[model samples]
Target: MRILIAGAGIAGLTTALSLHAAGLDEIRLVDAAPEIRPLGAGINLLPNAVRELADLGLDAAVGAAAVPTTELVYFSRHGDVIWREPRGRAAGHRWPQLSVHRGHLQMVLLAAAEERLGRGCVRADARVTDFCRLPTGRVRVTLAHRTGDTSTTTEVDALIGADGIRSGVRRVLFPDEGPPVWQRQVVWRGITKIPPFADGRSMFVGGDSTWKVVAYPIAPLPDAAGLVDTNWAVSRTFVPGEVVDRAGWDRVVDPAKLLAALDGWVFDSLDVGALIAAAAPFEQAMVDRDPLPRWTFGPVTLVGDAAHAMCPMGSNGTTQAIIDARALASAVAVEPDISTAFVAYERDRRERMTLLQNCNRALGPEVVVAMADRARSVIRPGPSARDLDRELAEISRRYAELGGFDVAAANAASSYSVRRRPHSARPAQQPAGS
Candidate 1:
């Protein structure tokens, strides 16, 4: 069947690979951008997403480029280690949670898609204008060039909208759905070369007034270089009716502003102030969205940010989209009728998407405030240093109590394989030059 997919982001690329794995042919992907540019900063590939990448033969490439995060440390305003816990493989999960630059990850996926799907399978600068149902029971997509030269329409057996939050396909499907709901928070993210801290894993420091900071190492440099590609994001409550000016938004943030926000943050071992000061080319905020009612309509369906764009607090946005690709592809492979495939795909995904969105919303406020307060406390000097080992133990126990390691069961129950890889007759290769 011929398939037309909008957006060449993670969701769209993964969907193309998944459909190809399902033995479907004639897949075409389009994006509004004239050229695919590296946008966003970093993303965490949870165990579930790692498994999906493994299925597509991309685990080796992606894993090689990422830093394996073993622990998640939380801190209070006074740099006190409030809590810490094992993560990914360290937490007993079969797969590892990889922390990498979003741009690197996108390049990896784009290269793989181009290689496996052939050239011209994915097209940039092709913006979807509208869609019409053909008498032959097919869907025709009308597209326009970014240069405004000419418009063309192509017919396909089915269509999938992976076009991100401001998806045109979503508007075509659900005209009543207005703009994405604002979550009243602004966020700033940037990557910097800095020395690793706290076992070189990832850290989330929460403070008062709904301010939070999430930082993780993306790549390691050679020698005693002491340089690691780190990504950090700061978030706070935004005023109602605030408009984000794109040009002004992209302007570098004053280090003093960041320092003031994180003033009292006292996370144990590492100095939060030093870390924030070290980061450069700061990008400003415009965080998340409220939930959507539905993500599917007839032969066309939505995935990723297009369907359910939520706060990045839980690190579930990209992971869920990858899961959606797998689920939708599986549904299409099983259901002979195109409409039935779309229905089954939405049925399996909608509930999970809602759950994720709700989870993010619930956690957003507390986490944000905790981060802000922690930052302020560090500079103000208020509390006694908490015992590190005892605090970490308490956190680990709490995670265990909360069933943090039960991700396998959750993934299995969704009818999606946590890991999907074809068995090979030959054993895997050893270290290079072996």
Candidate 2:
């Protein structure tokens, strides 16, 4: 079936790969960005997604561009440990979880798409302005050019809106819904070349619900001073009625402000002040849309942030999108009717994503830390700490289970076997996005 995928970021690109592997290649990808460029900071590929990528034969490409995270640790605002868990292969998952620069991961997926789907099959400077069902039982998507007032339209058997939070396709479908809704939370994201924190492959989260910082190494450990690029983010809660303009906020912000918000967040390993001083931070309002009742609308459906944008609480955004692509492709591969595939895909994904959205809104497993922090003054040591630890660990395990990726189950599941791509084959294409 001919398909048009909106947005060439992770979700759109991964969808292309999944469809291609399923023996369908009449897929076209487009992004609003004039050209694909390395954008954003670090992203996590949970074992479930790692398995999906391995199935598509891009594990080596991703491995070369990213670091395999070994463990995750959480700390309270006072720097007390809340929870720690092994990740990926370390956690016994068949596939290792990867933390990589978002742009780098996109480029890796882009190269694979171009190599397998043909170069330029993924277009830049194209934006889907609107889409609708056609008389011929197909979907027609309209594109507004970036450089001109000109626009183009195409008809396909199906359309996948893998476009991100500010998705035009979503706007057309829900004009009344408006832009992404933001809570009273604002987050500042930045990366720095600094001394590696903790284990070179570890990721850490410190602080409570109202304020927090997530830091992780985006690349392999450095050779010398142990300096590597580390991605860091700090989020603060604001007044509920606070106003934040989405268009006005670029990824860049003053580092001093971020440093101020994290004034006391000095841990033994991660130096919050030093990292923030390394560079400016990109400011963003912590926002998400209320989960929709259905993502399937005839031959059109949504994926990734477009489908269900959530808080960064659990770091589940990209993983959920990858799984969405996997399920959609699997559905399409087995179902003869594109419409039926849309139903199956949504059926398999919507409820899970909805649960994820709720979990994130309530701060997922991390909420326990905030609760513990508030009760710390009255709560004594000993059993109190042990009980909180037990609760946090269960929350962590429950999130993985809720997301359909129980760590142990993921490790034990027999992975799909695909022929290894020859080492002598073409090297990874460094697109203009590079």
Candidate 3:
């Protein structure tokens, strides 16, 4: 079957690989960018995403490029420890949670997809403009060149919209849905060389819902002065009706301004102000769309940020996208037809993504930090210390389970890999020569 994937980002690239592994070889990936470069800052891949990468036979490469995170610790605005737990293999999952630069991970996936699917299988400078279901049960996708008004079209058995939050495919599918809904929060993300904190392997999240900072080492090697390359994000929520223009990921923001947002937050292990001062960060408004009633419309379906864009609260945005790719490929390989596969894939992922979207909106596991801060001054006897500890752990545990990264379920979860069948390779489909 001829398959075309829109947006050559992590989600789209991984989808191509997953489809190839499932024994479906006719695949093409197109992106709006003229070139795919190593860009962006650090991102955490929970054990669940790591497992999917493992199934794709990419675990070794990814692990090599990233630091295996050992634990996650939540801290209050005053730098008091609120909750802490082991992560990845340390948490009992077979796979290790990895912290790596987003650009590095994307490059790894891009290399694998191109190697397996051939150089011609992936193309840049071609953006998906629109698509329609033809009478033959195939999709006619319109492609517009980035350089000029020139456009082309191709027919494919299926189209996967992994185009991210501002997906044009999603726009044509739900034109009236409008731009992503900003949650009145803004985040400044960057990586800086700083003294390693917490054994250089722990992910630290400090502050509460209104304002918070997350930092972790993305590299395994430490430089002189015992410093390691650390990734950090400082996020703050504005007033309910505050105005925040939807910004791209590449917008630069003043590091001083980000440090100012922290309001003098410093932990015994790390000083967030120093971290921010050490590097410039790109700024973006934290935004997401409401869960759609359906992601499948005939032979086309949405995945990743296109189908269910959630706030980066849970750090599962990339993880969920990778899972979507795997699940889509699995369904397509097992189901009787593309239509059935689309419906089945939607049915399986939409619910989970919807729950995750809502959970993120509710602050996910980070809610515990806010709760702990509030509990500091409770003259009225509420829950005891032990009860509160259980409650805090439960909050974190529930979010992990919902994201499919909880230790028990993740360790026991069956692989998403589909058995490969003997099939002849076919070149990617394209419009007739210009």
Candidate 4:
């Protein structure tokens, strides 16, 4: 079957790989970008995502570019430790959680897709305008070049919109849905050189209202330096009806304002002020969205951010997209009828995706504030280690259960036996600078 996938980001690339693995041929993937470049900052790969990557034989490539996160440390505004717990392999999961630059992840996926699927399978610089279903059951996709000098049309057995939050296909299918509902939160993220604090793999710190930060080491510095290239995001609630200044997307922020937001927050050991200061002129924003009821329409379906773009609170965006790619691919492999395959994919994914979206929204505020409160009193010097351990264990268990990682299903879907080894072998190297 010939398939047209829109967007070349994580979702789109994964979709291509999954379909190919399912024995589908004649795949055409398109992206609006004139050329693929390293974009975005950093991403946390949960165990579920790691399993999918492992299935694709890209685990080593991803691991080489990532810092194996050992623990998640929660803090209060005053630099108090609220809670800390092991992550990924250390947390008893079979797979390890990874922290890596978003660009690095995208590049890894793109390179793998292009190499295995062939260059002709992926197309960049083509922006899909819309798609229409033919009476004969085939789908016709219309695309135009941003340069305004070129246009093309393609007929495919199916279409998948992995186009991201501002997806054109979604608007075309659900016009009455209007614009995405803002979750009243703005976020800013960037990467910078910084010395590793505590365990280098730790994520989340400085839980406080108005200001909070999630930080992790993405890759080691290039010179084998002690400092790791860290990534972080700071977010706050947006005022009602505030007009977002598009020009200010990359605006530098005042360190004082950023620090003041966490003034009395009590989290863990990390210095909130020092970290924010280190993240000078931080990129900022208010962003999030309400859940969508459906992600599939006829033969065209949505995946990843396009289907359910929520706040980055729960490291589920990328994981959900990867899962979607696998699930949709599996459905198509089983159901010969394109329409039946699309319907089956949506029926299985929409509920889970919606649940994840709601979970992220519910956890957003607590991530920044609850940990702050816990940090205020939990990490004091000379505390009872037994008591602290118990508290930390409870928090870890609660979060693990609430995170919606269906261990049974994840394990079943993540059978590595189904994956083929890469054609070329390479030695595993330490993250950039080690």
Candidate 5:
């Protein structure tokens, strides 16, 4: 079936790749960016996402570009250890949790998509402006090209909106849904070349609900100075009545300001302040929208952040998008019609993504840090250390299960890949390199 995907970011590109694997090869991806550049900070790919990549024959390439995180540790504001657990393969999962630069990961996916979907499959400086469901059971999509004072249109069997939080398709679907709802927090993110800490392959989160610092090594190896490229993020919830500069949310801020905000966040091995001070940082308001009742609308549908933009409380945003691509592609391959495929895809994904949206809003596994902080209070009798650990472990376990990354579940889960249908629309085209 002919398909047009809006936004060539991770979600859209992955969707194209997944569709190609499922024998639905007539696809095109249009992006709003003037050019595809390697940009952005680090992102963590939990084992579930990695497993999908493995099925797509991309595991080795992505693993080579990332550091396979071995563990995750939580610390109180005072630097006291709250809880610690193994991760990825160390946690006995079939795949590894990968930490890589966000831009690098996108480029990796883009390369794979181009090789498999043909070089002409993606176009830059073009974006989806609007769409209409034609009577012929197809969707006619309008595209606004950046080059000329012109616009173009095309009809496709299906249209997938993989654009991010401020998706144009989403805007058309819910024109009244204004800007994304801010989560009342401002985050500063950056990467720095620093001497590896804590086994050099682990991630850590410190502080409480109001504020926290997270850091992990995103590079697979240290440089000549024995320093690894590390990614760090510092976030603070806004105080009541504090003014928010929404217009300046995407601006780059001075590292000194970040250091000031994270003052005194020093640990025995990790110094949050020092990390921020050493890197150039970009700041943004942590924002997401309420989950919609449905993501499929006739011949059109949404995926990734467009479908359910959730806070990154548990590092499941990217993973969920990858999963969405797989599920949607699998449905398209097996379902008889585009509308049926979209419905099946939505049925399979909507409930779980909605749960994740609420879960992240509640801080997901990071809730453990706040729980530990409360337990450490001297104002009243706190839960015993043993009891606290049990509770914290349970919270983490629930979140893992909720996010579809539970070790047992992920390892034993059926594959998302699908066999090419016997009655495909046409024979698969030769991949670019092949």
Candidate 6:
């Protein structure tokens, strides 16, 4: 079947690679971006995602470019440790949680798509305008040039939308969905070269929802000064009704304002102030669409952020996207017809992502901090720190399970493998490397 995937970002590119590995050869990718620019800050691939990448023969290459996150630690606004736990292979999983630059990861997936599917398979600067189903049961996708010139159309047997949170495909499918639900929380994220941090590969999340900080090294190895590139994010929240008219947030912002909020967030091991001071910050509105009723509609379906743009809490946004790639590709490989594949894919993914969306809205394990805050009360105390730690550990495990990262199960299951790679899927002469 001829397949067209929109938006060659992480989700779209990975989808292309997964489909090729599944033995589907007639696949093409396009993106709204005018060129292949590796844009964005750091991103994490939980064990679930890393496992699938390993199945694609990408573990070593991507891992080499990423910091294997050894632990996940949480702190209160006052810098007191709330909970801590080992992560990835450090936690006994078969795969390691990867903290890599999002742009770098995209480049990795893009390179893989090119090598495996042949170059020029992904058409950049081609933006999808609309789609229509032909009487023959094929899809006709209208592509407009980035320069707004003459438009063109391509016919494909199937279409998958991985176009990101503001997906036009989603708008076409759910016109009344309105704009993405914005939480009025703006995230200031950036990378900075700083002295080695805790464990050199641990991830740190500080403060409550109102104000927060997340810092982690994306580089597995340090540089000349024993320093590494660390990604730190600070968030500023708006009071109710404050962001109703807000329009843009994913733009560069003055870090000075964000830095001030970290005035006293310094820890003996981490200097939040220094990290903020050293990096330029880019602001992003914390946004997610309400879970859709359905992601697959006939031969057309949605993937990744296009399907479920949940809050970037719980580190599930990207994780779920790659997971979508795995499940969708697997379904396509097993099902007899295109429609069944789409239905099976949706059945396999929708409920889980819906639950994840809800869990992330509740802040996942971060809710434990709220519990701890209530614990300080004189009348009705909440869980003590010791008890909170135990509770938080359960919450973490629950999310791990929901996110498809059961340590024991993953370690025991046969390695995630591509069941097929039809001859047509590979070019006669692959570049001498992956």
Q: Pick the candidate with the highest TM-score.
A: 5
lDDT of 5 by residue, 362-390 (tens): 77789888777776742234467777878
Candidate 4 residues 1-434, lDDT tens each? 67889999999999888877767656779998898888988888888888888888898998998988887776655565566667787876778888888898899999998888897677888988888877666678989887767888988767889999888888888777776666666677667676776666777655555556788878843436777787877777555776655554557766665566654443344555566666665554544456777676667788888888877875777877887888777777666465667678888888767766776776542453554454454555555645655665665555455444544444455532223222211111211110
lDDT of model 1 at position 177: 77
Top of the candidates by lDDT: 5
TM-score of each: 0.83, 0.91, 0.93, 0.85, 0.94, 0.92
Better of 1 and 4 by TM-score: 4
Every candidate's lDDT? 0.70, 0.80, 0.84, 0.71, 0.85, 0.80
Which ranges in model 2 have alpha carbons more than 4 Å from their true place? 223-225, 239-248, 377-380, 412-434
lDDT of 3 by residue, 1-434 (tens): 88899998889998889889878888999898888898778888989899899888898998897999998998888887777899988888899999999898899999999899998788889999999876666789999996876899999878899999999899998889989997778888888999888777999988865788889999898977778999988888787777655544548877876666674788657988888887878888788999998898767889999999998886799999999999988887787666677788888899999999998887788877678777763223456756778888888888888999988878876557766756623322332111
lDDT (C-alpha) at residue 297 in model 2: 76
The 10-residue segment of model 6 with minimum total lDDT is 425-434
Residues 306-329, model 1: lDDT tens digits: 888877765667877888898887
Give one digit per residue, the lDDT tens place, for model 6 in 1-434.
68899999888988989888888888899898889888988989888888888888888888888999999887777777777789988899878889999998999899999999999999988988899777677778999886767689998878899999989778878878888887667778889999888779889987755787888999888898888999887776677866432443666766677666777676448889888887778777788889988887678899999999998877778888988988888888777667677788899889989998888777766676566555643123355545656677788879878877779766654333557845432221211110
RMSD of 2: 6.4
Q: Model 2, 1-434: lDDT tens per residue?
A: 67889999999999988877767768899888899998888988888888888788788888897899998887777777767888888887888889999998899999989999999898899999987765666677898886877899888777889999988888888889987777677788888899888888998887865787788999886858768999888877765666555552656867876666676676557877888887878887788998998787767889999999988876689888988888887777666566677788899889989999988887786776677677673135687777776777788889889876687667654333222222211111211110
Model 6 lDDT at residue 194: 90
| Local error of candidate 1 at residue 120 (angstroms) | 1.4
Clash count, predicted structure 3: 0
lDDT of 1 at 221: 47
Error of 6 at 381 (Å): 13
RMSD for each of the candidates: 8.5, 6.4, 4.0, 8.0, 4.5, 5.5
